[model samples]
Target chain A: MSHTTKEKSKLLARIRRLKGQMEAVERALEAEMPCGDILNLVASVRGAVNGLMGELIEDHIRMHVVDPGTETDSERAKGAADLIDVVRMYLK
Target chain B: MSHTTKEKSKLLARIRRLKGQMEAVERALEAEMPCGDILNLVASVRGAVNGLMGELIEDHIRMHVVDPGTETDSERAKGAADLIDVVRMYLK
Candidate 1:
Protein backbone atom coordinates (compact mmCIF):
# COMPACT_ATOMS: atom_id res chain seq x y z
CA MET A 1 0.00 0.00 0.00
CA SER A 2 1.09 3.51 -0.63
CA HIS A 3 1.98 5.76 2.28
CA THR A 4 -1.32 7.53 1.80
CA THR A 5 -3.34 4.32 2.00
CA LYS A 6 -1.53 3.40 5.19
CA GLU A 7 -2.15 6.83 6.62
CA LYS A 8 -5.66 7.16 5.22
CA SER A 9 -7.27 6.56 8.58
CA LYS A 10 -5.50 9.49 10.22
CA LEU A 11 -6.26 11.82 7.31
CA LEU A 12 -9.88 10.72 7.39
CA ALA A 13 -10.02 11.51 11.07
CA ARG A 14 -8.87 15.06 10.41
CA ILE A 15 -11.45 15.43 7.66
CA ARG A 16 -14.14 14.11 9.96
CA ARG A 17 -13.23 16.68 12.53
CA LEU A 18 -13.48 19.40 9.89
CA LYS A 19 -16.87 18.05 8.92
CA GLY A 20 -17.97 18.19 12.54
CA GLN A 21 -16.79 21.75 12.83
CA MET A 22 -18.77 22.67 9.73
CA GLU A 23 -21.80 20.95 11.19
CA ALA A 24 -21.42 22.99 14.32
CA VAL A 25 -21.55 26.10 12.20
CA GLU A 26 -24.69 24.80 10.55
CA ARG A 27 -26.26 24.02 13.88
CA ALA A 28 -25.43 27.44 15.18
CA LEU A 29 -27.13 28.95 12.18
CA GLU A 30 -30.19 26.74 12.60
CA ALA A 31 -30.56 27.86 16.19
CA GLU A 32 -30.35 31.46 15.08
CA MET A 33 -27.30 32.14 17.15
CA PRO A 34 -26.09 35.70 17.47
CA CYS A 35 -24.33 37.02 14.37
CA GLY A 36 -21.04 37.33 16.23
CA ASP A 37 -21.34 33.80 17.60
CA ILE A 38 -22.11 32.33 14.19
CA LEU A 39 -19.27 34.26 12.67
CA ASN A 40 -16.89 32.80 15.22
CA LEU A 41 -18.09 29.31 14.40
CA VAL A 42 -17.64 29.92 10.72
CA ALA A 43 -14.17 31.29 11.31
CA SER A 44 -13.30 28.18 13.31
CA VAL A 45 -14.36 25.93 10.45
CA ARG A 46 -12.32 27.99 8.00
CA GLY A 47 -9.26 27.72 10.20
CA ALA A 48 -9.66 23.94 10.50
CA VAL A 49 -9.95 23.54 6.74
CA ASN A 50 -6.94 25.79 6.21
CA GLY A 51 -4.90 23.73 8.66
CA LEU A 52 -5.83 20.54 6.84
CA MET A 53 -4.83 22.12 3.52
CA GLY A 54 -1.53 23.37 4.91
CA GLU A 55 -0.46 19.92 6.07
CA LEU A 56 -1.10 18.38 2.67
CA ILE A 57 0.68 21.15 0.73
CA GLU A 58 3.81 20.86 2.83
CA ASP A 59 4.11 17.14 2.10
CA HIS A 60 3.70 17.70 -1.64
CA ILE A 61 6.61 20.13 -1.67
CA ARG A 62 8.82 17.83 0.36
CA MET A 63 8.07 14.75 -1.71
CA HIS A 64 7.78 16.18 -5.21
CA VAL A 65 9.48 19.58 -5.31
CA VAL A 66 12.27 19.32 -2.78
CA ASP A 67 12.91 16.59 -0.28
CA PRO A 68 15.14 18.22 2.30
CA GLY A 69 16.71 14.83 2.94
CA THR A 70 18.15 14.62 -0.55
CA GLU A 71 18.12 18.08 -2.10
CA THR A 72 21.63 19.58 -2.52
CA ASP A 73 21.05 22.93 -4.18
CA SER A 74 21.10 25.61 -1.52
CA GLU A 75 19.17 28.11 -3.63
CA ARG A 76 16.43 25.62 -4.53
CA ALA A 77 16.22 24.50 -0.93
CA LYS A 78 15.80 28.07 0.24
CA GLY A 79 13.07 28.63 -2.31
CA ALA A 80 11.19 25.57 -1.21
CA ALA A 81 11.53 26.58 2.43
CA ASP A 82 10.29 30.05 1.59
CA LEU A 83 7.29 28.66 -0.25
CA ILE A 84 6.47 26.47 2.70
CA ASP A 85 6.69 29.34 5.10
CA VAL A 86 4.35 31.37 2.93
CA VAL A 87 1.90 28.51 2.72
CA ARG A 88 1.81 28.24 6.48
CA MET A 89 1.29 31.96 6.91
CA TYR A 90 -1.44 31.99 4.29
CA LEU A 91 -3.32 29.21 5.98
CA LYS A 92 -3.09 30.98 9.30
CA MET B 1 3.70 41.40 5.50
CA SER B 2 3.22 37.76 6.28
CA HIS B 3 4.85 35.20 3.99
CA THR B 4 1.50 34.22 2.63
CA THR B 5 0.61 37.76 1.73
CA LYS B 6 3.95 38.18 0.05
CA GLU B 7 3.44 35.00 -1.91
CA LYS B 8 -0.23 35.55 -2.54
CA SER B 9 0.20 36.19 -6.25
CA LYS B 10 1.85 32.86 -6.90
CA LEU B 11 -0.67 31.02 -4.76
CA LEU B 12 -3.47 32.81 -6.56
CA ALA B 13 -2.02 31.71 -9.86
CA ARG B 14 -2.22 28.09 -8.81
CA ILE B 15 -5.79 28.58 -7.63
CA ARG B 16 -6.66 30.12 -10.96
CA ARG B 17 -5.27 27.14 -12.76
CA LEU B 18 -7.40 24.88 -10.63
CA LYS B 19 -10.41 27.02 -11.36
CA GLY B 20 -9.68 26.83 -15.05
CA GLN B 21 -9.42 23.06 -14.86
CA MET B 22 -12.76 22.89 -13.11
CA GLU B 23 -14.28 25.11 -15.74
CA ALA B 24 -12.93 22.86 -18.44
CA VAL B 25 -14.75 19.95 -16.83
CA GLU B 26 -17.93 21.96 -16.73
CA ARG B 27 -17.52 22.94 -20.34
CA ALA B 28 -16.97 19.35 -21.35
CA LEU B 29 -20.19 18.42 -19.65
CA GLU B 30 -22.07 21.18 -21.37
CA ALA B 31 -20.64 20.19 -24.75
CA GLU B 32 -22.03 16.69 -24.26
CA MET B 33 -18.63 15.10 -24.29
CA PRO B 34 -18.53 11.33 -24.08
CA CYS B 35 -18.79 9.86 -20.60
CA GLY B 36 -15.19 8.69 -20.76
CA ASP B 37 -13.96 12.07 -21.84
CA ILE B 38 -15.94 13.79 -19.14
CA LEU B 39 -14.67 11.35 -16.60
CA ASN B 40 -11.11 12.03 -17.68
CA LEU B 41 -11.66 15.74 -17.34
CA VAL B 42 -13.17 15.26 -13.90
CA ALA B 43 -10.28 13.09 -12.85
CA SER B 44 -7.87 15.77 -13.99
CA VAL B 45 -9.66 18.31 -11.86
CA ARG B 46 -9.60 15.96 -8.90
CA GLY B 47 -5.88 15.42 -9.27
CA ALA B 48 -5.28 19.12 -9.41
CA VAL B 49 -7.29 19.63 -6.25
CA ASN B 50 -5.41 16.84 -4.50
CA GLY B 51 -2.13 18.44 -5.48
CA LEU B 52 -3.25 21.75 -4.06
CA MET B 53 -4.45 20.14 -0.86
CA GLY B 54 -1.25 18.17 -0.49
CA GLU B 55 0.90 21.27 -0.70
CA LEU B 56 -1.15 23.04 1.95
CA ILE B 57 -1.28 20.13 4.40
CA GLU B 58 2.48 19.49 4.24
CA ASP B 59 3.16 23.11 5.12
CA HIS B 60 0.80 22.96 8.08
CA ILE B 61 2.62 20.02 9.65
CA ARG B 62 5.97 21.68 9.18
CA MET B 63 4.81 24.96 10.66
CA HIS B 64 2.70 23.61 13.51
CA VAL B 65 3.55 19.99 14.23
CA VAL B 66 7.27 19.53 13.54
CA ASP B 67 9.34 22.02 11.64
CA PRO B 68 12.38 20.10 10.43
CA GLY B 69 14.74 22.99 11.17
CA THR B 70 14.41 23.30 14.92
CA GLU B 71 13.07 19.87 15.81
CA THR B 72 15.76 17.89 17.65
CA ASP B 73 14.01 14.78 18.88
CA SER B 74 14.79 11.80 16.69
CA GLU B 75 11.51 10.05 17.40
CA ARG B 76 9.44 13.11 16.72
CA ALA B 77 11.32 13.81 13.52
CA LYS B 78 10.75 10.28 12.36
CA GLY B 79 7.06 10.57 13.08
CA ALA B 80 6.84 13.82 11.16
CA ALA B 81 8.70 12.34 8.22
CA ASP B 82 6.41 9.34 8.25
CA LEU B 83 3.32 11.50 8.35
CA ILE B 84 4.60 13.61 5.45
CA ASP B 85 5.29 10.52 3.37
CA VAL B 86 1.79 9.25 3.98
CA VAL B 87 0.29 12.60 3.12
CA ARG B 88 2.18 12.74 -0.16
CA MET B 89 1.16 9.18 -0.99
CA TYR B 90 -2.46 9.80 -0.14
CA LEU B 91 -2.65 12.96 -2.20
CA LYS B 92 -1.14 11.16 -5.15
Candidate 2:
Protein backbone atom coordinates (compact mmCIF):
# COMPACT_ATOMS: atom_id res chain seq x y z
CA MET A 1 0.00 0.00 0.00
CA SER A 2 1.21 3.44 -0.87
CA HIS A 3 0.26 6.78 0.62
CA THR A 4 1.16 10.39 0.52
CA THR A 5 3.79 11.30 3.08
CA LYS A 6 1.42 13.20 5.34
CA GLU A 7 -1.18 10.44 5.29
CA LYS A 8 1.42 7.91 6.23
CA SER A 9 2.65 10.15 9.00
CA LYS A 10 -0.82 10.65 10.39
CA LEU A 11 -1.44 6.93 10.42
CA LEU A 12 1.84 6.34 12.16
CA ALA A 13 0.74 8.83 14.78
CA ARG A 14 -2.51 6.96 15.26
CA ILE A 15 -0.61 3.70 15.75
CA ARG A 16 1.54 5.36 18.40
CA ARG A 17 -1.57 6.55 20.16
CA LEU A 18 -3.01 3.08 20.04
CA LYS A 19 0.17 1.68 21.53
CA GLY A 20 -0.17 4.14 24.37
CA GLN A 21 -3.76 3.09 24.86
CA MET A 22 -2.65 -0.53 25.11
CA GLU A 23 -0.01 0.38 27.65
CA ALA A 24 -2.55 2.29 29.69
CA VAL A 25 -4.67 -0.82 29.88
CA GLU A 26 -1.70 -2.87 31.02
CA ARG A 27 -0.87 -0.32 33.66
CA ALA A 28 -4.41 -0.26 34.88
CA LEU A 29 -4.47 -4.01 35.28
CA GLU A 30 -1.13 -4.15 37.07
CA ALA A 31 -2.04 -1.31 39.40
CA GLU A 32 -5.20 -3.11 40.48
CA MET A 33 -7.44 -0.47 39.11
CA PRO A 34 -11.11 -1.11 39.74
CA CYS A 35 -12.34 -3.86 37.47
CA GLY A 36 -15.13 -1.71 36.12
CA ASP A 37 -12.83 1.16 35.26
CA ILE A 38 -10.28 -1.12 33.69
CA LEU A 39 -12.89 -2.86 31.66
CA ASN A 40 -14.26 0.47 30.54
CA LEU A 41 -10.87 1.52 29.26
CA VAL A 42 -10.50 -1.81 27.50
CA ALA A 43 -13.87 -1.44 25.86
CA SER A 44 -12.91 2.02 24.62
CA VAL A 45 -9.71 0.77 23.12
CA ARG A 46 -11.50 -2.12 21.46
CA GLY A 47 -13.92 0.32 19.91
CA ALA A 48 -11.08 2.38 18.55
CA VAL A 49 -9.52 -0.73 17.09
CA ASN A 50 -12.77 -1.72 15.50
CA GLY A 51 -13.21 1.74 14.04
CA LEU A 52 -9.86 1.39 12.39
CA MET A 53 -10.80 -2.02 11.04
CA GLY A 54 -14.04 -0.76 9.57
CA GLU A 55 -12.26 2.04 7.80
CA LEU A 56 -9.68 -0.33 6.39
CA ILE A 57 -12.25 -2.85 5.25
CA GLU A 58 -14.42 -0.19 3.63
CA ASP A 59 -11.52 1.26 1.70
CA HIS A 60 -10.35 -2.16 0.55
CA ILE A 61 -13.75 -3.22 -0.66
CA ARG A 62 -14.43 0.02 -2.45
CA MET A 63 -11.20 -0.34 -4.32
CA HIS A 64 -11.52 -4.02 -5.14
CA VAL A 65 -15.23 -4.62 -5.27
CA VAL A 66 -16.30 -1.38 -6.86
CA ASP A 67 -13.43 -0.76 -9.26
CA PRO A 68 -11.09 -3.62 -9.87
CA GLY A 69 -9.40 -2.49 -13.08
CA THR A 70 -8.77 -4.98 -15.84
CA GLU A 71 -7.84 -7.68 -13.37
CA THR A 72 -7.93 -11.34 -14.25
CA ASP A 73 -11.00 -13.36 -13.38
CA SER A 74 -9.19 -15.15 -10.59
CA GLU A 75 -8.04 -11.92 -9.00
CA ARG A 76 -11.52 -10.43 -9.08
CA ALA A 77 -12.92 -13.55 -7.52
CA LYS A 78 -10.26 -13.38 -4.83
CA GLY A 79 -11.24 -9.84 -3.95
CA ALA A 80 -14.83 -11.01 -3.53
CA ALA A 81 -13.74 -13.89 -1.34
CA ASP A 82 -11.63 -11.58 0.78
CA LEU A 83 -14.57 -9.28 1.38
CA ILE A 84 -16.75 -12.18 2.46
CA ASP A 85 -14.11 -13.57 4.80
CA VAL A 86 -13.39 -10.18 6.35
CA VAL A 87 -17.06 -9.51 6.94
CA ARG A 88 -17.55 -12.98 8.37
CA MET A 89 -14.67 -12.66 10.79
CA TYR A 90 -14.90 -9.08 11.93
CA LEU A 91 -18.64 -8.60 11.75
CA LYS A 92 -19.06 -11.65 13.95
CA MET B 1 -17.89 -9.02 -5.05
CA SER B 2 -18.87 -12.34 -6.44
CA HIS B 3 -17.68 -15.91 -6.61
CA THR B 4 -18.91 -19.20 -8.01
CA THR B 5 -21.33 -21.03 -5.77
CA LYS B 6 -18.84 -23.80 -5.06
CA GLU B 7 -16.09 -21.36 -4.12
CA LYS B 8 -18.33 -19.53 -1.73
CA SER B 9 -19.43 -22.81 -0.22
CA LYS B 10 -15.82 -23.89 0.36
CA LEU B 11 -14.92 -20.66 2.06
CA LEU B 12 -17.95 -20.90 4.30
CA ALA B 13 -16.94 -24.43 5.21
CA ARG B 14 -13.48 -23.26 6.19
CA ILE B 15 -15.01 -20.61 8.41
CA ARG B 16 -17.18 -23.25 10.05
CA ARG B 17 -14.11 -25.38 10.69
CA LEU B 18 -12.38 -22.42 12.25
CA LYS B 19 -15.38 -21.92 14.48
CA GLY B 20 -15.17 -25.54 15.52
CA GLN B 21 -11.50 -25.11 16.35
CA MET B 22 -12.37 -22.15 18.52
CA GLU B 23 -14.99 -24.23 20.34
CA ALA B 24 -12.47 -26.99 20.89
CA VAL B 25 -10.18 -24.58 22.68
CA GLU B 26 -13.02 -23.48 24.92
CA ARG B 27 -13.93 -27.05 25.75
CA ALA B 28 -10.32 -27.93 26.43
CA LEU B 29 -10.07 -25.16 28.99
CA GLU B 30 -13.35 -26.06 30.69
CA ALA B 31 -12.50 -29.73 30.85
CA GLU B 32 -9.54 -29.05 33.12
CA MET B 33 -6.95 -29.92 30.59
CA PRO B 34 -3.44 -29.58 32.02
CA CYS B 35 -2.31 -25.99 32.10
CA GLY B 36 0.37 -26.65 29.55
CA ASP B 37 -2.08 -28.36 27.23
CA ILE B 38 -4.60 -25.58 27.61
CA LEU B 39 -2.03 -22.93 26.85
CA ASN B 40 -0.89 -24.91 23.85
CA LEU B 41 -4.40 -25.06 22.52
CA VAL B 42 -4.87 -21.35 23.04
CA ALA B 43 -1.64 -20.64 21.23
CA SER B 44 -2.74 -22.83 18.35
CA VAL B 45 -6.00 -20.94 18.07
CA ARG B 46 -4.21 -17.63 18.08
CA GLY B 47 -1.90 -18.81 15.31
CA ALA B 48 -4.82 -19.98 13.24
CA VAL B 49 -6.54 -16.64 13.67
CA ASN B 50 -3.41 -14.79 12.60
CA GLY B 51 -3.08 -17.02 9.56
CA LEU B 52 -6.58 -16.12 8.52
CA MET B 53 -5.88 -12.44 9.03
CA GLY B 54 -2.77 -12.64 6.88
CA GLU B 55 -4.64 -14.27 4.05
CA LEU B 56 -7.39 -11.69 4.19
CA ILE B 57 -4.93 -8.84 4.25
CA GLU B 58 -2.98 -10.19 1.33
CA ASP B 59 -6.04 -10.58 -0.82
CA HIS B 60 -7.27 -7.10 0.08
CA ILE B 61 -3.96 -5.46 -0.67
CA ARG B 62 -3.47 -7.23 -3.95
CA MET B 63 -6.84 -6.16 -5.25
CA HIS B 64 -6.68 -2.56 -4.08
CA VAL B 65 -3.04 -1.88 -4.72
CA VAL B 66 -2.51 -3.74 -7.95
CA ASP B 67 -5.75 -3.32 -9.79
CA PRO B 68 -7.89 -0.52 -8.48
CA GLY B 69 -10.03 0.67 -11.37
CA THR B 70 -10.66 4.32 -12.31
CA GLU B 71 -11.58 5.27 -8.80
CA THR B 72 -11.85 8.83 -7.74
CA ASP B 73 -8.55 10.31 -6.59
CA SER B 74 -9.67 10.48 -2.98
CA GLU B 75 -10.80 6.89 -3.04
CA ARG B 76 -7.46 5.73 -4.34
CA ALA B 77 -5.65 7.74 -1.74
CA LYS B 78 -7.87 6.32 0.97
CA GLY B 79 -7.04 2.80 -0.14
CA ALA B 80 -3.36 3.56 0.11
CA ALA B 81 -3.84 5.10 3.50
CA ASP B 82 -5.83 2.11 4.71
CA LEU B 83 -3.09 -0.28 3.67
CA ILE B 84 -0.52 1.74 5.53
CA ASP B 85 -2.64 1.83 8.64
CA VAL B 86 -3.30 -1.88 8.54
CA VAL B 87 0.41 -2.65 8.18
CA ARG B 88 1.24 -0.26 11.00
CA MET B 89 -1.33 -1.78 13.32
CA TYR B 90 -0.88 -5.50 12.71
CA LEU B 91 2.76 -5.63 11.69
CA LYS B 92 3.76 -3.98 14.91
Candidate 3:
Protein backbone atom coordinates (compact mmCIF):
# COMPACT_ATOMS: atom_id res chain seq x y z
CA MET A 1 0.00 0.00 0.00
CA SER A 2 1.32 3.43 -0.88
CA HIS A 3 0.14 4.99 2.38
CA THR A 4 -0.10 8.18 0.35
CA THR A 5 -3.76 7.80 -0.43
CA LYS A 6 -5.47 11.11 -0.03
CA GLU A 7 -9.02 12.25 -0.78
CA LYS A 8 -8.43 11.85 -4.49
CA SER A 9 -8.00 8.15 -3.90
CA LYS A 10 -11.23 7.91 -1.94
CA LEU A 11 -12.92 9.52 -4.95
CA LEU A 12 -11.91 6.55 -7.05
CA ALA A 13 -14.07 4.19 -5.06
CA ARG A 14 -16.95 6.64 -5.07
CA ILE A 15 -16.86 6.64 -8.85
CA ARG A 16 -16.97 2.87 -9.09
CA ARG A 17 -20.07 2.45 -6.93
CA LEU A 18 -21.64 5.24 -8.93
CA LYS A 19 -20.72 3.46 -12.12
CA GLY A 20 -22.63 0.43 -10.94
CA GLN A 21 -25.70 2.57 -10.32
CA MET A 22 -25.37 4.23 -13.69
CA GLU A 23 -25.15 0.88 -15.40
CA ALA A 24 -28.18 -0.28 -13.51
CA VAL A 25 -30.06 2.75 -14.72
CA GLU A 26 -29.03 1.93 -18.25
CA ARG A 27 -30.15 -1.63 -17.81
CA ALA A 28 -33.50 -0.54 -16.47
CA LEU A 29 -34.00 1.63 -19.47
CA GLU A 30 -33.00 -1.16 -21.80
CA ALA A 31 -35.41 -3.52 -20.12
CA GLU A 32 -38.31 -1.21 -21.04
CA MET A 33 -39.13 -0.22 -17.51
CA PRO A 34 -41.84 2.35 -16.87
CA CYS A 35 -40.71 5.86 -17.74
CA GLY A 36 -41.73 7.24 -14.35
CA ASP A 37 -39.76 4.63 -12.43
CA ILE A 38 -36.76 4.97 -14.71
CA LEU A 39 -36.79 8.72 -14.35
CA ASN A 40 -37.06 8.48 -10.58
CA LEU A 41 -34.08 6.18 -10.58
CA VAL A 42 -32.25 8.65 -12.78
CA ALA A 43 -33.10 11.52 -10.47
CA SER A 44 -31.90 9.85 -7.31
CA VAL A 45 -28.80 8.65 -9.04
CA ARG A 46 -28.23 12.23 -10.08
CA GLY A 47 -28.14 13.49 -6.49
CA ALA A 48 -25.90 10.75 -5.20
CA VAL A 49 -23.61 11.27 -8.15
CA ASN A 50 -23.45 15.02 -7.78
CA GLY A 51 -22.63 14.78 -4.10
CA LEU A 52 -19.66 12.68 -5.06
CA MET A 53 -18.58 15.35 -7.51
CA GLY A 54 -18.93 18.15 -4.97
CA GLU A 55 -16.65 16.27 -2.60
CA LEU A 56 -14.20 15.70 -5.40
CA ILE A 57 -13.96 19.29 -6.59
CA GLU A 58 -13.66 20.49 -3.03
CA ASP A 59 -10.76 18.12 -2.63
CA HIS A 60 -9.18 19.36 -5.85
CA ILE A 61 -9.30 22.87 -4.48
CA ARG A 62 -7.64 21.67 -1.31
CA MET A 63 -5.10 19.44 -3.00
CA HIS A 64 -4.18 21.56 -6.00
CA VAL A 65 -5.81 24.93 -6.58
CA VAL A 66 -5.57 26.47 -3.13
CA ASP A 67 -2.69 24.39 -1.87
CA PRO A 68 0.60 26.22 -1.48
CA GLY A 69 2.47 23.11 -2.49
CA THR A 70 1.38 23.56 -6.09
CA GLU A 71 4.26 25.98 -6.76
CA THR A 72 3.41 28.62 -9.42
CA ASP A 73 0.39 30.64 -8.43
CA SER A 74 -0.29 31.71 -12.00
CA GLU A 75 -0.04 28.12 -13.07
CA ARG A 76 -2.56 27.08 -10.48
CA ALA A 77 -4.91 29.83 -11.54
CA LYS A 78 -4.59 28.78 -15.13
CA GLY A 79 -5.21 25.23 -14.08
CA ALA A 80 -8.37 26.32 -12.32
CA ALA A 81 -9.42 28.26 -15.36
CA ASP A 82 -8.77 25.31 -17.60
CA LEU A 83 -10.80 23.15 -15.27
CA ILE A 84 -13.69 25.56 -15.53
CA ASP A 85 -13.49 25.48 -19.26
CA VAL A 86 -13.56 21.75 -19.33
CA VAL A 87 -16.54 21.60 -16.99
CA ARG A 88 -18.52 24.06 -19.05
CA MET A 89 -17.97 21.85 -22.02
CA TYR A 90 -19.09 18.78 -20.14
CA LEU A 91 -22.21 20.49 -18.81
CA LYS A 92 -23.06 21.82 -22.24
CA MET B 1 -0.37 21.49 -19.13
CA SER B 2 1.46 18.87 -17.15
CA HIS B 3 1.13 16.60 -20.19
CA THR B 4 -0.72 14.23 -17.92
CA THR B 5 -4.36 15.33 -17.80
CA LYS B 6 -5.80 11.87 -17.78
CA GLU B 7 -9.56 11.36 -17.48
CA LYS B 8 -9.34 11.94 -13.73
CA SER B 9 -7.83 15.31 -14.49
CA LYS B 10 -10.79 16.16 -16.68
CA LEU B 11 -13.04 15.07 -13.82
CA LEU B 12 -11.61 17.82 -11.63
CA ALA B 13 -13.10 20.34 -14.01
CA ARG B 14 -16.39 18.47 -14.21
CA ILE B 15 -16.82 18.90 -10.46
CA ARG B 16 -16.41 22.69 -10.41
CA ARG B 17 -19.39 23.24 -12.71
CA LEU B 18 -21.49 20.92 -10.56
CA LYS B 19 -20.43 22.90 -7.51
CA GLY B 20 -21.75 26.05 -9.12
CA GLN B 21 -25.04 24.37 -9.92
CA MET B 22 -25.32 23.07 -6.37
CA GLU B 23 -24.78 26.57 -5.04
CA ALA B 24 -27.51 27.80 -7.34
CA VAL B 25 -29.85 25.17 -5.94
CA GLU B 26 -29.06 26.28 -2.43
CA ARG B 27 -29.76 29.85 -3.41
CA ALA B 28 -33.07 28.85 -4.95
CA LEU B 29 -34.01 27.13 -1.73
CA GLU B 30 -33.01 30.15 0.29
CA ALA B 31 -35.04 32.33 -2.03
CA GLU B 32 -38.09 30.12 -1.54
CA MET B 33 -38.31 29.02 -5.10
CA PRO B 34 -41.07 26.57 -5.98
CA CYS B 35 -40.28 23.07 -4.80
CA GLY B 36 -40.84 21.59 -8.22
CA ASP B 37 -38.48 24.02 -9.89
CA ILE B 38 -35.87 23.59 -7.18
CA LEU B 39 -36.15 19.83 -7.44
CA ASN B 40 -35.72 19.93 -11.17
CA LEU B 41 -32.61 22.00 -10.71
CA VAL B 42 -31.29 19.56 -8.16
CA ALA B 43 -32.04 16.61 -10.38
CA SER B 44 -30.25 18.05 -13.41
CA VAL B 45 -27.28 18.97 -11.29
CA ARG B 46 -27.15 15.46 -9.92
CA GLY B 47 -26.86 13.84 -13.33
CA ALA B 48 -24.16 16.19 -14.48
CA VAL B 49 -22.35 15.69 -11.21
CA ASN B 50 -22.56 11.90 -11.21
CA GLY B 51 -21.42 11.69 -14.79
CA LEU B 52 -18.29 13.48 -13.69
CA MET B 53 -17.72 10.94 -10.94
CA GLY B 54 -18.17 8.01 -13.29
CA GLU B 55 -15.47 9.42 -15.53
CA LEU B 56 -13.24 9.90 -12.51
CA ILE B 57 -13.57 6.34 -11.26
CA GLU B 58 -13.00 4.94 -14.71
CA ASP B 59 -9.83 6.97 -14.89
CA HIS B 60 -8.70 5.72 -11.50
CA ILE B 61 -9.12 2.17 -12.65
CA ARG B 62 -7.08 2.97 -15.73
CA MET B 63 -4.47 4.91 -13.81
CA HIS B 64 -4.17 3.12 -10.47
CA VAL B 65 -6.42 0.20 -9.59
CA VAL B 66 -6.08 -1.55 -12.93
CA ASP B 67 -2.88 0.00 -14.16
CA PRO B 68 0.03 -2.26 -14.94
CA GLY B 69 2.33 0.40 -13.55
CA THR B 70 0.67 -0.07 -10.17
CA GLU B 71 3.36 -2.73 -9.39
CA THR B 72 1.68 -4.76 -6.64
CA ASP B 73 -1.44 -6.79 -7.30
CA SER B 74 -2.34 -7.17 -3.63
CA GLU B 75 -1.81 -3.51 -3.07
CA ARG B 76 -4.08 -2.62 -5.97
CA ALA B 77 -6.73 -5.00 -4.68
CA LYS B 78 -6.50 -3.39 -1.27
CA GLY B 79 -6.81 0.00 -2.83
CA ALA B 80 -9.93 -1.12 -4.66
CA ALA B 81 -11.47 -2.52 -1.48
CA ASP B 82 -10.66 0.57 0.54
CA LEU B 83 -12.27 2.62 -2.19
CA ILE B 84 -15.42 0.50 -2.01
CA ASP B 85 -15.60 0.89 1.77
CA VAL B 86 -15.18 4.61 1.61
CA VAL B 87 -17.76 4.95 -1.17
CA ARG B 88 -20.30 2.89 0.78
CA MET B 89 -19.91 5.31 3.65
CA TYR B 90 -20.40 8.26 1.34
CA LEU B 91 -23.42 6.67 -0.32
CA LYS B 92 -25.15 6.03 2.98
Task: For model 1, report DockQ.
Answer: 0.03
TM-score winner, 1 or 2 = 1
Evaluated on CA atoms against the true complex, candidate 2 attains a DockQ of 0.14
Worst 10 residues of 3 chain A by lDDT: A1-10
Residue B5 CA displacement from its true place in model 1, Å: 4.5
lDDT per residue as tens, model 3, A1-92: 11113432353455455555656655654555544454456556676755654544544444544543454787776766666556545533
2 against 3, candidate with superior DockQ? 2
The lDDT values for all models are 0.72, 0.62, 0.51
Clashes of each: 22, 0, 1
Model 1's number of clashes is: 22
Residue B48 of model 2: what lDDT? 72
Q: Score the docking of each candidate (DockQ).
A: 0.03, 0.14, 0.04
Candidate 1 lDDT, tens digit per residue, B3-90? Answer: 3465578779989999898899889888998999988888888888878877766666566446655667664466567666866775
Q: With candidate 3 superimposed using the best TM-score fit, by how many Å does residue B77's alpha carbon deviate from the native?
A: 56
Ten contiguous residues with the weakest lDDT in model 2 chain A: A62-71
lDDT of 1 by residue, A1-92 (tens): 34345568988999999889888988988999899999898888887877887777666656544555566766446656765776676554
* Native interface contacts kept by each candidate, as a fraction: 0.00, 0.08, 0.07
Name the top lDDT candidate: 1
| Candidate 2: CAPRI quality band | incorrect
- In model 3, the runs with Cα more than 4 Å from the true position are A1-5, A67-92, B1-92
